[model samples]
Target chain A: MSLEIRNLHARIAANGTEILRGLDLTVEAGKVHAIMGPNGSGKSTLSKVLGGHPDYEVTEGEVLLDGVNILGMEPDVRSRAGLFLAFQYPMEIPGVSNANFLRAALQARLPEGEELEATDYYARLYEKMDMLEMDRKFTARSVNDGFSGGEKKRNEILQMLMLEPRYAILDETDSGLDIDALKIVSHGVNAMRGPERGFLVITHYQRLLDYIVPDVVHVLVGGRIEHTGGKELALELEAKGYDWIKDDIAQAVSA
Target chain B: MNATIEAPIETVSEENDSLMTTGPDFASHPEAFRARQRAAWEKFVSLPMPARTDETWRFADVKSLSIAPYTRAEVVDDGDRAALLKKSIGIVETSGRMVFANDCLLARDIYNDTLRAKGVLWLPMEQAIAEQAELIEKHFMRESGVLGSAKFAALHESQVKAGTFLYVPRGVEIALPVETFHWLSGEGASVFPHTLIIAEENAKVTLVDYFQSAGDDAGFACGVNDIVVGNGARVTYVAVQDWNRKTLAFHLNNTTVARDASALALRLNLGGSRVRDEAVSRLRGPGGRSDMLSVSAAEDDQIFDQRTLQIHEAPNTSSDLLYKNSLNDKARTIFTGLIRVDEGAHKTDAYQKVRNLLLSDEAEANSAPGLEIEADDVRCTHGATSGQVDMEEIFYLQSRGIPLRLAHQLVTFGFLNEVIERLPGEPLQQKLRELLHGKLG
Candidate 1:
């Protein structure tokens, strides 16, 4: 089974400017796929569209998680259907404690009238927080309010660990992270990897690949996938930049 | 079972007999107190109801200010009293507590003996008037409180019977907060509750007043509280007003701070069909400070009209006021506040901020913040803002699987918590948070 997107086309709902143009990708359940792209290549927009953000309209596309289409579902419904997106810029929910926020999110997954056991919930939360090296006080603090850049990213990973979605998308999770924070965040994501889950790591540079190495790397340019290779492709792009691939795509289009 | 057992027979007008339950202790009260009550009743009758044309009643639902259909509270039955006593459990660790139902005292528990021995006096208003008449008279409703509720204030003074009277002597500090609960129980019944706090120089104390209804009954509540802070004293006061949705209520407060003394007052308005709240703080001494805070979670057709005034009467004094409101359904809220720096009160610092989070498109919020400055080099800032919950914030929660309704509530709670967190003491904060959660949910 795999998470697959086929011939996806989307546009900005406000201005009708197309962002995703016939994008196609597949992430096998047991593999980690990385999408490396230049600026304005629809990296973040793809994640938002996949999450069912209202700002973007899918003109034509079908997203299948384990052979069931989720394109018609609401954002929250998509999440309950096993799709999770790690936002590039996590929102700051003032006055909502991280513990309560995570609890509510987890509680939403339960069947009606089924109460979440508080003792076990806190136990699992503490364990996951410890794995992330998060201080105990973070749970009591407002969700992402006044959090440092690295701390917010770590909080995103912390939530991913708790929710444990079937198909997870990391949308530029490496931006604004220092070297040390990068390693810690990578560790958290790495700990979640297994044969039952799939990951789509979207990023601009290849530095993140060094820690969470990908099984396959795809070059996305002009809102379309232009090249596909193994993990070494990330190193080559980092050394050569995106110009070489853009030139190749230009020549291919002309030919 | 005459509800007006304490009302004097001679002074009870036919109209008032149907409208008010005077305290049972009124006949035995000192002549001076009785005379003042009689005069207040006359004043209440003479004063006209606030009209929409009145500046103080601007944007208010003046039609709903009718108290003619409500009568004074009657004595609750034993069973009702027991239930209310059980529900009166608030903060776990209070130094003293007094529970009242239908203007009658049900339970009085003072847990700390050391405080009792330290010349700390906490007694019912009637008992305090009997035992400390001069002391109660000195600070009882000293301010006219002319913030659009003068008629209600007069009505409260005319029929008020039982409340909390706290007197903290100089050099005595109560380590724990004192608590009082006023519960109104009856259909079409009304209650006049009063609280007078006097903190002596160099003393410290905290007090919490809870105005709750025993049930969801349409009633009327007119209450008043006056706080006097002496020099070098610290006082924190919080009033949690959770009357039922069918109730019409008025809560008026006047606080005076002396040199080097600081006072903090927080009001949480959760329930009421129509609630008018007026708060005034006067910094009468240099180096004094006052923090005025309020949080209201109004829903359905509830209306919360709050007016406030901060008077900087002395140089170097400071006052900060923050009021937050969250409205849902067709609920409405109005906030009007003024910070006035009196002449010769140089170096005064004052701030006023009001924030409204409208959760529904039909919900409405109106705000007016003003400053009247007569002194030079004084710092004053006032602002009011109305905004809906951020869609991005909602999306963030939904992306994590939280349903839309639940996500909206969590964000609203967070918006109001900014004011709740400013109060000191964790246990109290936890209790307030729990109460807020229940109301929002």
Candidate 2:
């Protein structure tokens, strides 16, 4: 099974400004793909559109998860279909404890009348917290409430690890993370990289690519992938900057 | 005690009044009790109805505050009474339980024999008036209802016949809380349930009052609870009001804090057509503290009006008040609270805050928080805020695969849980949360 986005076109709800234009990509299981793009290049928009954000409208195109059309599904339905989006700015839900919030999410996925055992839930929760270097006290604290930037990112990763979605998208997860936090988060992501899962890592900086090297790196220039290369492309782009790709696209269009 | 018995009583010739209108049967022991009832009844009639322009009653449905049609309900059939007693269960593990319906004691289950031996008096108000006449006469309705429900307070005092009287002696600590349920049945029924609790020196106790309806019958409930915390004593009181949707209710509470004593009182409002609550906490002695909290969920056309006052009379006294409401549909809520520090009550720390979460565009919430500081060195702050549920919070929950309806429910619960979790007792909190969930469901 794979996540397929076919000729996707999307726009912002506020001004009707088109961000994604005829973009197509596929991510098969057991692979990590990174989408590197500069500011205003629709990287975040793509993540949101795939997650069925109501603010972003898909003018035309289809998003299919495991060969089933997902564009018609609600945001929550899309999530229940094994698509998880790690938000660049995770929202703080005050008064909802981390443990309870996670438990609710997991409970939502279960069949009706089936209950999750509290003993096993706590054990797994503690395990994930330890892996992300989060304080055990966070279990009782409100979800992302009063947390630092680094702590919020770690919490996102903790959620991703707990949810274990089929196709997980990390949108700018490395933006606010420090070197130490980056390593910890990348370690958590790396541990989940296997034959049963696929990942789409979206970031603006190449520094994150060094920690969790992707199997393939795609440079999105104007809503679509302008170039596809190996891990070395990330180093080259980091050294020469996105100006080269922009110049190449300009030259090609003019010709 | 002797003075209460020697006071003259009024002779009323109303044949339709089923309640013991002249005086309670036990009023013979304390004649002053009967005289006080007469005086309270006169005061009840003398006080004018709350006006629309009154600051404390602003935005309140003053027109619906009439109590003309409600008459005292008589005891029902034995089968219905037994069914109600069976449904009066509250906390699973309680030291004692007393059930009352239609201002009459239905059943009592005081399990802790040791507490009985330790001079803890857990009995019906009538029984206490006869057996513990001195204690009941001294502490019953001792504090005035200073938060703008004086008329209703007087009405409660005049018709009060059945309730719970819990007296915890010096140095005694009850492990489990005591539960008292007042069930109102029959149409146009009026029940006055009074709870008077006195915790003597260094004693610790908790009393939970549940005001509920047997069915969907329309009724009236005028409840008055007086709590007195003696020197260094600790008392936690919770009142859960779940009347019928067509019922009108008035609950007046007064807490008197003595030297180094601390008192916490919480009121949970779930169901009622129009519910008015007036709570006052008096910090009378040094090192006294009071915590006043309330959580309400109002939906449909229900209206919940709350008024509170915190009076700091001595130095080194503190009080904090927090009230939260989640409104939906065309429901309305009003909160008027004030924190007053007396002239000589220096170093007093008082805080008053009210938060309203509007869940619907049609819902309305009005808040008025005020502070009067006469002390030279005091820290007092009062603020009120009204807003809808945070969009970001909703998105966060929605993004997690939770349906919109369940997400809203969870957010509302979380909003109200901020106040519920602050409660000191766990059992009562759980029970209240369950009731809240049932109402939402």
Candidate 3:
């Protein structure tokens, strides 16, 4: 099984500014891939396009989870098909409690006219929450409302754990997190690592790569993956910075 | 509380022979109450019907009201009575509970004997009128219906028989809530429900009242609630007005707070084709506080007209009103609230907020929030907001695999739960939420 992107192309719907131009990538099951890029390099746009965010429109190509094209599907339909997006900025639904929100998500995964067992649901929720170091009280508190930046990141991990999507994309999940929170979040992500799941971790800084050690690394430049290599590529990019990749692309285009 | 499922609705034979001359059987009560009831009947007859020119009657569907078709509710048979009593369950454990069907007492459950031993007066209106006549006289139907429904209020005063009169003696704090249920059964029957709670100095008490219909029978419900909070007393009142979808209802409330006392009242309107709700909270003494909260779900052709007034008359007093409504289908809701800080009531803090969630293109919501501040050193704010479900919020929920319909329902519940969560009792809040979900379902 794989999350295959076949020459995916997208642009901002309101303004016809193209972001993902002829992008190609494949995140096969049982692998963690990292996409490193500089600011305005379409890193976030890629995530939003894959998640079917309404602001972005796919002009061409396809995003397939398990060989089924999800580009035309609604966001929720894609999610039910086992695609998950960990938002860069988790939304705070003011009146919905975290436990209730999680419960609704899990309930939605169930078939029509069926309900999730309450005790089983809470048991699993508390177990996953413990992994993220979240307090039990948050189960009753509003989702992400008045949460710290680190807390929001942890909550995103918590949701990813609860949903257990077949393919997950964590977009800047390590941002705004302290070193301690970063390690804890990475630990939680690592705990979910297995052959049954695939992950795409997108970040601008390589500090996150230190914890989430990807099996494959790609440098995103000018709306495309300019270079692909082993995990060592992250260390090389961190040392040389994104300017080197930009210069390489510029030189290649001129030549 | 039981879920609002398709329970077997036993229809009762209705008798429409009653007239304005018909009166409630208030035997053994003092004559003064009877005289007061007579005066109320006369007042109900003399006051002209709400007309188009009346400011309070603006935007109200005056044409749909047919009071002539509704007669005083007759007593139900034992079978229907037992069925209604079975349906009267609200919370598993309560300090006391009384169930009434068609304005007749069906069952009485008082689990706490210490409450009686501690001089807590928990009596039905019939008994309370004779036993606690002075207290009843001082507080019963004391406030005129200023926000409209004066005619309905007078009718309730003249017709109410089965009600609750709760008094918490000085410093007496009841751990659990006391509940009352009024079930209307016969078609075209009308029931008047009243609750008057008096908390003595430094006392604390919580009371919940439920209005329901035994079946899908069309009915008329007029309910009045009065909360009298004494010095340093704390009173929490909840009214769940869950009439049938075909019923027409009116719920009027008045609250008075003494020095340093605090009063909180929450009303949940779930059903009814047309409902007019009016609430007024008067902070009468220094340091007194009042919190008025309401949540309503109107769907189909339902219409909810709500008006509220918060008057801060003394310095250092505060009053807050939050009313939320979710309108769907062709539902219509009107919310008008005024927060008034009287002169010399310096340091007053008053707030009035009304939020309407429109769930349909055809649904209409009108909101008017006003503030009158004659005092200088007071902080007062009032606002009314009408908005559809936030797309981003719904998208957030939908991205987690929740269907669009479920996501809309979740966000709507989230919108109204803000007021439901304000309640102090956990069981009642859970019951309210469950009932709310059932209604939506």
Candidate 4:
């Protein structure tokens, strides 16, 4: 089983500016693939387009999740179909408690007329929260309101763990994180990796790759993968820079 | 209960054609009180109904000012009366309580003789006039509230038969709230509910009034509240207006704070077809403070018109007014408030804020917040904001798999809880929370 993207083309819905141009990628279950790109490389656009954000329009693309096309599904529907996108900037929902928000999300996944078991829900929630080192009081606070950067990332991981999606995309999850917080977040992400799930990690810095080593490293440029190699490619790109990959692509295209 | 009215023949004739509850027994009240009621009737007859042109009546539906459809309410049958009493269950614990249905007393509870021995007077209005005549005459209907509802206030004075009177002596503190429940039953029934509170120097007390309709019947409600806070005294008043969706209501309030005294008031609106509420808080002495707060959750074609005034008449006095409304399903709300700091009232601090959360595209909210600061060295700020549910927040919840409808409700309730949390006591806050939830759900 895999999440296969075939010749994906997308643009900004508001201004009709192209971002993702003819991109192809495949992420197989049981493996963690890391996409390294510089600023304005449309890396973030890929995650948002896959999640059906209203601001992006997928003009030509086929997203097959285990051979089932999910291009037309709404974000919430796609979420229930085992596709999760851990937001780079988690929104702050004032007045809604974290515990209640999580409960509603979980409740929506239940069958019709069936209610969620409050005891079981809270038990599992606390267990995941403990893994993330969250305070018990955090459950009563508004979702993401007044949260620190690292805390928001950790909360995202908590959500990912609770949702238990078949495929997950973590976008810039290491940005704005201190060393201690980075290790904690990475540990949580590592704990969730298993043979039954696929992970696509997108980051700009090689610092995060050291902790959560990628099984395959793909260098993305101009909305397409320009180079692919095993984990050693990460060290090569760390030594040289994204500009070196850009030159290589230009030369190959000109030839 | 008996009452007497000795108004001119012309006024009585007009009342006979339009009034419904004025039986001959209605004139059985004390002579002194009867004289006042007669004068009020004459005034009510002379005054004309407020027109939309009146500044206080701006955005008000003047066409609904007809009084011909309603007459005085009669006592319900025993079966209905028992049910009405059962429906009158308020907060479980109170220092005292009085329940009235259709202008008739169904039940009452008061503290023991020890309370009366300590110079605390908690009695029905009819009885209070006979026993505590001196205090009643001093503070009864002291001011014709200036919030554009003087005509309705006059009508309340002329026909008011159901009310409560509370008087606390110097240095006496009643730790618990005293409650009054006024319920209306039967179609085309009308009620005039009133509450008068007097707090002597250094006394502290809390009072709450509940106005509810017994059934899904069309009715009319005209009510008023008068509170006088003495030096260093503390008084709080909470009014919960939950009539049936088919009723029209007019409620007026006047509060005066003395030297170093503080007064706090809150009004919550959950029901009624159309409601006009007016409140005036006057900081009459130095070091006095007033906190006026309100919350309204309107849905399904409901209209709530709110008007308020905070007058700082003395130096070093302060007043704050905050009103929050959540509108859904084509409901509408209007808020017009002003803060007037008098000349020479230096060092005054006054604030007026109105927040409206719109949940439906068709719902409407209007706000006019103004300030006239004549004093120097004073601080005043006024602001009104109208907003919808943040879509980003909604998307965040939806990304977690929560549906859109539930996400909207969660954000709206969160907007309202901020106001309910401002209430001082736990029981009142909890009671209001439950009421809000029941109405919203």
Candidates in order, interface RMSD in Å: 0.6, 1.2, 0.9, 1.3
Looking at model 2, give its docking quality level: medium
> Against the true structure, whose TM-score is highest?
1
DockQ (C-alpha based) per candidate is: 0.87, 0.66, 0.77, 0.59
lDDT of 2: 0.87
C-alpha TM-scores of all predictions: 0.97, 0.92, 0.95, 0.90
- For chain B alone, what TM-score does every candidate structure achieve against the true structure? 0.96, 0.93, 0.94, 0.94
The chain A TM-scores for the candidates, taken one by one, are 0.99, 0.98, 0.99, 0.98
Per-candidate local distance difference test: 0.91, 0.87, 0.87, 0.86
Best by lDDT: 1
Model 4 residue B291 lDDT?
94
Model 1 agreement with the true structure over A1-255: per-residue lDDT tens digits: 899999899999999999989999999997999999999999999999999999999999889999999999888999999999999999999999999999999999999999999999999999998988999999889999999999999999999999999999999999999999999999998998999999999999899999999999998988788899999999999999999999998898899
Model 3 error, position A47 (Å) = 1.2
lDDT of 4 by residue, B69-130 (tens): 77778778899878877787667677878888887788887753434548888877767766
lDDT of 2 by residue, B240-296 (tens): 999999899999988999999999999999989999999999999999999999999
Q: List, in the given order, the native-contact fraction of each candidate.
A: 0.87, 0.56, 0.72, 0.67
Q: Which candidate is the best by DockQ?
A: 1
Number of clashes in every candidate structure? 1, 5, 0, 10
Clashing pairs in 3: none
Model 2 TM-score, all chains together: 0.92
Off by over 4 Å in 2: A112-137, B1-29, B111-114
Candidate 2: count the clashes: 5
